[model samples]
Target chain A: MSLCVLEKVSKTYTTGDLVVYALRQVDLTIDPGEFVAVMGPSGSGKTTLMNILGCLDVPSSGRYALAGKDVTAMDDDELSRMRSEHIGFIFQSFHLLPYATALENVLLPTLYLERPVDGGKSRALELLSLVGLEDRAHFRPNQLSGGQQQRVAIARALMNDPELVLADEPTGALDTTTAAGIMRLLSSLNERGKTIVVVTHDPEVAAYARRVIRMRDGVPTEQPSGRTPRPLTAHPPVTP
Target chain B: MRRFISSLHQALKAVRAFKLRAVFCIASVALGISAITVIVAATEGAYRRAYEMVDRFGPDAMLVLGGSAEARAIGRRDKTITVQDVEALRQAFPTAYLLVPMSSVREVNISYGNRRHQTRVTGTTEGYSRSWSWPVVDGRDLSEADVKGMRNVALIGAQVARELFANTDPIGKFFFVRNVAVRVVGVLEERGTTGAGHNLDDRIVMPITTAMKKLMNEKTYVNAVRIRFLDARNMGRYRQEVRAFLRQRHGLKPGQPDDFRLLSSEEIIRFLVALTGSLVIFIGITGVMALVVAGFVLANLFLLSVSERSGEIGIRRAVGARRRDILFQFLLEAIALTLVGGLLGFVLGVAAGPLLKLAADFPIYFSWKAFAAGLILSMLVGLIFGLQPARRAAAVHPIQAIRSG
Candidate 1:
């Protein structure tokens, strides 16, 4: 079964007299252990699509299934439980609690679950080490560099060993080198049999994903793939 | 329970983070509570002392005195209360076990050689001591022989002894009451001053016969007659019998008003008790108003704290704390603060009671009930005042809060 499937999903937001169509008849399927990137311009409904897939929001109409269980009609508490158990989110702004230490921040997800997974602390520490932040476990978010804070956010996202990892412009605010480092960490997590979905406007960041789906005006378009074109030997060079 | 403990600990930690503000809040509440405690304790002490003094006078004793109107209409021509009235009352009422005619001569100058002072002198029969329950501290009381013989003897109070003797023994000494010499046979024990601040132990007692025959010249009627009933439950019967006897002795018609007034010690005590109760209630209401103001101050302080710590509350809620949890946390902070303040005020009030007594020149007693009331009232105030701010804290939206941060 696919990890997440959205069929004919739509989302609309009404602010006063104007109605905004954030998503229109969106259809997608993501399988286990796959890396996909969603690229679009600002206001092209990428974040809205991400929010729907992460269960932070519901589509106005249609079916959303996670691991073959229909979740579009779930209540608020059920959705929170689903987020706690099945989904992990990383935001570009690195939303870490300012007062908590890095380790405490990572422990937050497991606290919401009804019961902690075995060896929760050790798992949290292992995830911190996975992101190369094991030495900064006791430091608060304010004391860390932006790159380190983003790495801690990534570590916190994996605290519950979630099946699907969603990154919304994970390195949008970082330097090129730090962004490359984050992309590499995400790629490594994808290699470890975790399904990864990243939404970004940066083509270079999208290059690291195995599959890239481009979005335009709240719709997705598939691109031709799978074969490398033959090199035209010398004749095509400078013909003009 | 463990969660409650941790929550309380966090509440206290939050208060401790801002020490000066917490101290200011506590001190304001303490001042109000202490004021209430002092008033309640002093009022209770005064009532207790008044009751003790009333109890010292005999339980079933009643006073029959000439009324002002009757004394005026007679114009010294008709006798109001006299030795004959006492004799008649004793004869008419077998229930009247002890009837003594007594009169007071205020501002009488007494002298013993060089020492001279003005004092009140009360003349009564030997039954006066037993009827009034006044204990003789030293020497001997007046005897029937002294009364019949009209002997020149007197019993002085504690203050008179201190003033005239200057630590010397006063028994067997001779003192002159308005130029008439009298022998001192006994000294009364020191009875504390009355609720009205009259010194009960600052007077001299003389035999009625001697006081009437020698100093006062036996020419005037007596001031009043004190009667004691055999059984206190028969007081009404005794009162009726005395009224009838006075009417017959004075030859009054059925429609004519009685010549004298009859009052019981119980009646006087009841009046005084009611007065004290009203005073206590008045003072209590004032204290409650102050407490309410303190409660408002506390509410304002907590509201300010909630506003200042909105970010912290947002963080806690985001970390899986329920709305009820947040409310309890803030309420716990308020209750803890006020409870500490209440206890401190109780301790200070108790310690200050003696000093208050010295300042007011009256006795003050510590009461646990008042302390308990202060503590409970303070906690109740905290709970009531804390509700609004706690609810506000609980209602903060986590999503909006996070976005703002």
Candidate 2:
């Protein structure tokens, strides 16, 4: 079964004397172990699509299924549980809690779990180390640089060992070198059988993904990876 | 329970974020709870003192006075409890009692040669000592012979002795009360004061016979009669019996209230307590208003901060917090804040207790109920005040929070 499947989904909004279509008819599926990129300019419904896919927002019509379970049929709490257990989201600005240390931020998802996570602190520290931030685990967000903060966010995203990790402009605030370094880290995670989805308008960011789906005015078009093949062993592996 | 702890943890974070607002919220609650605590303690203390005075007034004692309550209010003595009534009362009741017929003339000028002092002249029998459970500190009490012979011997109170004799012995001294000369054969026991702040030990006591005949020139009546029964639990029956006997002896028709009034010790305490009850009500309202005002402050601040904290709420929601979790977090913040304030208020009230007692001679009692009330009232305010803001916080959309942030 596919990791995620969206079948003929449409999301609409109504304002005073006007109607807006954020997502028209859309059908998409994501398989496990695939690095998928969702690319679109501003107002192309890419953000809305990612929100619906992340279970933060519901569709106006049609079905969204995750791991054979229907997303639209789930209640708010059920959706919360699904997000906590199976999916991890990374925001463009790296929405890390300003007051919490990097290790505490990574352990945030465990606070909402159905059962207590044993060895949660050690796991958080290990994830921080996986993102090359083991020594910065105790540092607050204000104390960490932009790239380091994003790395802390990535470690947080991987806290519960979620099956699918979604990144919305994961490198939007970073320089080219830092952005490439982040993409390489994500690509390495995809190699280890985690389903990764990267949402961005930058073509350079899309070059790291194995598959790309471009959305224009609420409609999506699929494209294969257009970059020349590169050697995988150029950098050290980030896998745990 | 797990969800509650999680919410509590997050609530602490929220409180830490807005330190000024949190402090103000807590200060208001503390003020309210402290007011309630002090009021409760004061009222409780007043009742305790009132009851103590009543107990001292008499254990199983009832006093029959000479006038109507309304007439006494304006300082008019209607001359009711007479010689006939006293005789009838002595014959009617079981005489295994301390029955004392007494009459008093307040503001009488008593002169001991060069020393002149104004004091109440009370005329009663020797059992005045036993009836009051107040033994004479020096000299001797009034005797039964003194009452029967209508002698001019008297017992001066400690204050009267101090005033009339200065450092000299008041025993064997001659004092004249309004042209009636009396020899001070015994000094009365020193009583400090009544609960009504009347000086108990500033009177000169002579025989009721001498007082009626010699000082006030009255032979037909005595103004007061005091009775002490065996058991206090049977006081209700005693009150009815006394009322019936007095009315029958006084020749009253049916449905006519007796000219003479009867009072029980318990009734006196209850009357005083009822007075304090009004005071408690008045002050209790102010305390409750303080709490309500604090609650309003807390609610207003919470509502104001919700918009600012929406982004935080959104972040939590995206991280898998349920809507109720967000709501619980905010509610817990208010409850916890006020709980702390309540405890602090209780401490403040208790701390102020001794100072109030010293300053105003107030009776301030500390009981667990006051403590519990402080806690329960504070928490209730928090819950009531926090609900709206928590709901608003819980309703924040993650997309909007991210955009706003």
Candidate 3:
């Protein structure tokens, strides 16, 4: 079964007299273990599409099934629960709490969960080690480099073991080499059967996914890669 | 429990970040609470002092003073309280233990040889000594002959004797008051202040007959009469009986109001407690208003905080925080701020009690109830004022907030 399904989804905003369509007539589905990239220029609605899929924003008019649940019918609290349970987000700016250590930020989601997740601390440490930041677990976000911060964000995204990872320009603030390193890490995560959706305007960033969906004027066109997306061969290994 | 701790942790970090603002808020609240505590302490001290006075005077002690409804209506002060009234009261309450009619001349000039001083001169019967628990320490008290013969023998207070005669023996010393020769027969024991800072030992006691017939040449008048019941248990009944008898003797018809006022030591204590009670309550209300204003300032500060941390709030929302979670987080932050402020206020208030006593001789009582009230009020004010900002913080759209940042 598809992990996410969108049927004729549309979102519109009325600013005074003019109506702006952020997303329009979108039909999409992602099966388990799929890695998809949404690419578009600024104002092309790629972020809006990612937001809808992540359950951060509901479509103005559409039917949305997230993990086979009717997401379109959910209220704010229900949407929050869906986001907490099934979706993990990686933002472009690497939004780590400035005052909190890397490890604490990773454990933040579990702290807000309805039921206590047993062994949450160990799971957070394991995710940090997965991202090769276990040694820097005690370092605050401001103390870490851009690459390390993005790595911590990646670890946090995986903290809940969500069904889908929505990364919105995850490496947008990083240098080329660091971006390549992040892509390699995401590729490994995808290889481990985590369904990952990356939203980016950069072609090089989108090249890491098996399938690319290009958005223009709130609509999408699918372009299936002929072969598996290549990970950077020059990047360091996953294990430190 | 974990969530609560996490939220508390986040709030502490926020408070630390805005250290100056937090300090100012706490200080403002502390000032208000301290004021409340000081008033409570002072009033409690006054109440205790009044109670002590009542105990000293004994429960059966009663007074009939000059200023009554009929006296005020008649607009005559000199003859309002008369010897006749005292005689009538004694006749009515024939079994009374002791009754004394007393009057005073304020700021009278009295000279002993070269040393001259101005002081209060009280005139009364010999019953004044026993009725008020004042005893002569040197020489002898006045006899019945002193009053009947209208003699000029005087009982001087310790303070008056010390000021006038210095080391010279006061007994048998002659003093000229109103240019009339008066012999000091006794020196009364020292009585301290009246607790209201009035000197109790700065007086000269003389027989009422001398004061009325010789010095001032006034007759048939006394300022007030002091009475002690023989049986203490009959005090309430005697108090009512005296009032009724006096009203009849003065020919005051029903509803015409009493020509004289009857008071007991108990009534005086109750009056004083009520007076101080209302004053303390007024001051308490003012302090509470100050606290409410502080709460408003706190709420305003938190609202500014919410606005400043909108990006962080949005981030939390995206990461799975429900609206209620955000609300709870901010509410907890407010409560934590106020409770800590309350604690600081309580400490400051407790400290101020001794300082106030040192500075102004004001008494302070620090009860657990006042401490708890100040703290609980702090929390309650925080919750009331912090609600609007917390709700605003919770209502932000994650997508819009993220984009705005």
Model 2 backbone overlap count: 0
Residue by residue across B61-143, what tens digits does model 2's lDDT show?
98888887778888886788888777777788884288888888999998988888999988888788788788877787888
Compared with the true structure, the alpha-carbon lDDT of candidate 2 equals: 0.85
Model 1 lDDT per residue over B285-384, tens place: 8767877877888788888877767756644554445566678888888888888878877777787778877765554667787688779877887788
TM-score for each prediction?
A: 0.70, 0.82, 0.76
What CA root-mean-square deviation does each model show from the true structure? 7.8, 5.4, 6.8
Q: Which sections of candidate 1 miss by over 4 Å? A: A1-240, B18-28, B57-81, B84-98, B107-118, B161-175, B195-197, B218-220, B224-287, B293-310, B344-364
Evaluated against the true chain A, what TM-score does chain A of model 3 have? 0.93
- Across B1-405, the per-residue lDDT of candidate 3 in tens digits comes to 777777777777766667876887777777777767667666777777777788767677898877676666778673467888888878888778799998888898999888889988888988888888889999999888998888999999989999899988999988998788999999988988886687888999999999877666788778889998888888888888888887777778897866678778768788777867776787788888888888888888889988877877888898889888888888877877788888888888788779877875654677776687778888887799889999999998888777665
List the lowest-lDDT window of 10 residues for candidate 3 chain B: B71-80
DockQ numbers for every candidate? 0.14, 0.50, 0.50
Clashing pairs in 3: B41-B365
Q: What is the lDDT of residue B62 in candidate 1?
A: 88
The TM-score, computed over Cα atoms with residue i paired to residue i, of candidate 3 is 0.76
Global local distance difference test of model 1: 0.78
Better of 2 and 3 by TM-score: 2
